[model samples]
Target chain A: MTNEIARPLFATALRLTRNRDDAEDLVQEALYRGFRSLSTFRKGSRFRAWMFRILHNVFINRVRRQQLAPRATDPADLAPSDHDHPIPDLRDIRELPEVADRHFDERVKAAVDSLPDAFRVPMVLFSLGALSYQEIADALEIPIGTVMSRLHRARRHLRTELADYAREHGLAPDPHAPEGAGS
Target chain B: MKCVEFRAQLFPYLDGELDEAATGTAAAHVADCADCAGRTAFERALEKRLQTALLADVGALDSVALVAAARRSPPLDSPTPASAVSSGVSSSSTGTSSSTRTGRPGHVLRFLTARRLLAVAAALLIAVQAAWFFCIPPFECSYLQAVERTVDAEGTPLRPGVVGPPLAERIEVTPEVLGYRLEGEATVVDLGLGETANSAVRARYAQNGEVVHVVWSDMGGAEPSFRRKREFDGRSWWVATENGHNLVAWMCPVTESLCTLVSELPEERLLDVADKLRAAER
Candidate 1:
């Protein structure tokens, strides 16, 4: 079981925890619990996805005691009209230019790490850990709608960083892609 | 409205968590949009590179190393302060001394004095203890001894009833660094002889030069009792105690003969040995 699922589960987990040491710990812990509860995993479903769900759950529980940053940082000025506060940069991943191409996985980790723990974890589960919005909400004990909005914003943030990375790395916009868009 | 906005939603689109219709619209936009496409591919590559780095060079695991570490004492549960562990005093001092602070305000001078006092106290406590151990000859017996206190007249001795049989002969040593060891002695006694005796009889002995440090000891169960060893006679020499005298058979090889005085050892030595501590900072 370790051999089969180790790669996918760890790859996704590493994305969440960029530090190799922490990722190894997370993978070991997640896999150990996953095997213990293998009886709960129905065989036909995607093992990778199910394992990720478990990992995301394990990560959440491990961090429950950690006081997440008080929504102290600037909430994005471009608040979605429907929300109470300005939407947090759910996908501010693109602003993580140094992490882009340089150490993509590590950048994801750093970006995720910088995210107020509240949004980062849930967002990663939905985006990379491969949990559905409902799965994320259930695992995180948050409402599904919150999971959706955070994920949406996280991706936007990621795009911002990735674009800067492309520009700096001399990677042109997808050539057949667009012109003058660098503006 | 922008390439950045489209790329932000890309991961969610791939996750299929976006509402089906919104997912389709995002997919359609990315397919036609060069900038969004470029951003997604780059981010994906970055993510892949990170995964590879995390997986690489996990280091070869040696089972012997693991087992040896596991068999040693686990880490002590207290935090050691940095000041307590400082090593290598610099060769040159800045020539600063308490008297140098003569003109400073009283509070500042007192603070410096207090720090110097603390350093002196720690140095005396630890460094002095280490020095005392190597420099001083054994002034007192390594431990106190009660000779002839509880031994019986018959040569057969009773076993000390403590955590284990009172007098044990055991030595535990491992071949590697980062290891804990327990070494040295036990004697087996027939419990039938000691049915009425509340303690075990042992002769705790050490050899210094040609003289054997021996003490006739009658010990309560399981407690380690120390007795000055007896002098060695070239041949079999025996000394009498309140209990039956212990007989020592001398041989050319002294250490082996010292061990022959006692028989059976404790059933177990130590427990809960471990390693694998997390790297943490306070």
Candidate 2:
């Protein structure tokens, strides 16, 4: 029972945390917390989704804390360094978009990984879970406006990246490439 | 409105998030404006194409595992201030209510999955159970081979004793039921013996699967409690319990497909509980 619930959620954490050991540790902790607070959970709703959201929240908070931490000044007192450091910057994400399309799966996976958290999440929610913007807002605890803006930027970013991808790979024009008179 | 403003508000316009007045203006502008339509079409196309590149990549993300891990290392739990989990969401009645409301699924699964969850919860439950029946050895009952149930145990069944001890040099789990999975020169402490064996299985019987049943041995073998199936919810789940371990089996017919699935073996749960206890003890 727990395995079915934890496996997919664990997989999500692995993608987010990107450290296998950290991912495993995070999974264990989530189950402990989830079970401890089990009384608060609702019935008939999706358990995996609920817990997955919790795990995502937990991972995001850690990232935010690290981002907020004093880098050089606090290296001594800082959190343990992880092997899979997050792509905290937008520029880096834009550079690595799609990994040159050598392998379709690898290409796409790299593209998603390249996106910043703001864009990566709604993208995951909409693309992965098919959640609407409002639903995305609910899942991530962000406002409706923020959700819209992030999604908008994500689309634009993906378009800009994929356009370069098409040009470089000798692929056809992006179906999204601006048509006549739109620009 | 110019195409510029329309382009800026395209997503909101598509989602109809704009005010009623702005909505009217955007619609009027789009109908008369080919350029805006083209851009609108472009943005829409961008979203669609991105979706295609992205949708397949989405599930490729192991979301469940990630979330599960996140749940474990909650920054909120890391000796931080209480207000941390609420960092993004301001303290409000609505937000609190939503979080509280969202808590329902976990509760319900906890309730409905009572038996199965308990049976399979030990960290080693699946592994030990799998090991006990097919992967490892001893305590594997012959009766269980014919019975296959699709059951899952969530969480863990074992309480921690000691954790982080190295695995004994000769300690290993063998894949043979009715044979000691733990190899030679292993010090095993029985949890259910005398004072330690205070914990008991909480069984809720079902109406099905009463044809052939097994039970636990208590009351000096005359009153066997762990090795029997009790009636529950219009069915009888095969009940098998060891000293400190508990295993139950029940089958639910798939409405679309008619097939029977049985739960795990007798000592599987106990083995999980015991394995965890041992690991923690180490």
Candidate 3:
């Protein structure tokens, strides 16, 4: 059952973990737990979401137990979008130099890496292009409102950063269009 | 909904998470509002680009092997083959129970057909047994053979009821019996008697001018009651104090011999001497 979604699941793990080795371990552990508790899986539910939920849970547990940074940092202090309101304008970004697709992808990864765990988790799950806001909320054990808020803040942060990269590469936002137009 | 509210609901509306009313309102607001429409479009494009950028190359992980491994091991929540057990047994009678049914009727038929014959046989057996054991009363439950306490002729209380010391003759010792040759002359004493009394044998071994008396006797299955006891090789040995000597005594279960070593040496040394003598015999 989990084999159907294994690659996408590993992709989710890789996105969340960043390190290839850690991602492999996370994927294996998630699959192990998924298959172990397969009987508990609801028949009509999505297996991908289920596997990702396990992966997210395992990763969060490992992070908390190891007292790793970002997770160990006060969750209350890291409340997504609670204090750090993103600037809404897309025009502040500079034009960027041309870069390869891999470079662009690496830039996106670096942008994700820059996000705090509280924002990063929901963002990664959202970007995985699979889980619903409710599913992300359920997976992260947070509220739907918190999920929306974190995602909104994450996208705003990404747009700002990526918009700057675009402009630095001479791919500036349309100057005559709306303030938050595509960069 | 206002443009600000529409902007706030942009991700929810794009993600299709808004309820019917909110979706309708947000969609209507975005459709009519150019700025909101452009913002939503940009956001949608960014989401698409994010997905493309973040889509991981996961071909390298061996998920097939992982799934196989998972299937091989029973789920932690699932009942393992090792742990599966029968829930119950049903007691419904099988064909094998015909013997029980057959036996039940035989007693009834015998009682009906031969009641007088059964009574005659029972009576004859009872009469014969009356002449055999119970009629004489010797074969009855009375314990006439039980040993009785006796006062010796010397007016001293004696344990005549004590079962035994076996009829062992005097024996000479090799140095192995003591594990060391005596520094002085050793004495072998025969303290055993015939069936008239419990029998015993003793060897007084002198080492470094210190005399240790080792006595072996047959206890005839009597439990050795000692004041101090310690366990050795899953058996108990008693250490008793008697006449300025410490006696470490134990029974050899195989030989049915109760052996005692009396030594003027301290309790530990006495036990050591007993242990060496036992080891040599082994």
Per-residue alpha-carbon lDDT of candidate 1 for residues B15-113, written as tens digits (9 for 90 to 100) = 444654566677677777876666556555544443343333222223332222222211112212222112211111111111221233343443444
Ranking by DockQ: 2, 3, 1
lDDT of 2 by residue, A62-143 (tens): 5555453223333222323221221111121222224233454445546666766656666655544434566568777767
Q: Compute the lDDT of residue B205 as modeled in candidate 3.
A: 45
Q: What C-alpha lDDT, on a 0 to 100 scale, does residue A3 get in candidate 2?
A: 33
Displacement of residue A37 (Cα, Å) in model 2 is: 4.0
lDDT tens string, model 3, A39-154? 45542255456667888887876565444535434464455453356435453334222233777777887888777777888887766626778889899777887887778777
lDDT, each prediction: 0.38, 0.40, 0.49
Candidate 1 true-interface contact recovery? 0.03
DockQ comparisons of all candidates to the true complex = 0.03, 0.09, 0.08
**lDDT by residue for model 2 (B67-130), tens:** 4333333233323424423533111211122122224324344334433333334444445334
- Candidate no. 1 TM-score: 0.37
What docking grade does candidate 2 earn? Answer: incorrect
Q: Candidates sorted by TM-score, descending order?
A: 3, 2, 1
Estimated TM-score per prediction?
0.37, 0.37, 0.47
- Stretches of candidate 1 off by over 4 Å are A2-4, A15-18, A42-46, A65-109, A166-183, B1-14, B18-282
Q: What's the DockQ of model 2?
A: 0.09
Positional deviation of A21 in candidate 2, in angstroms?
7.6
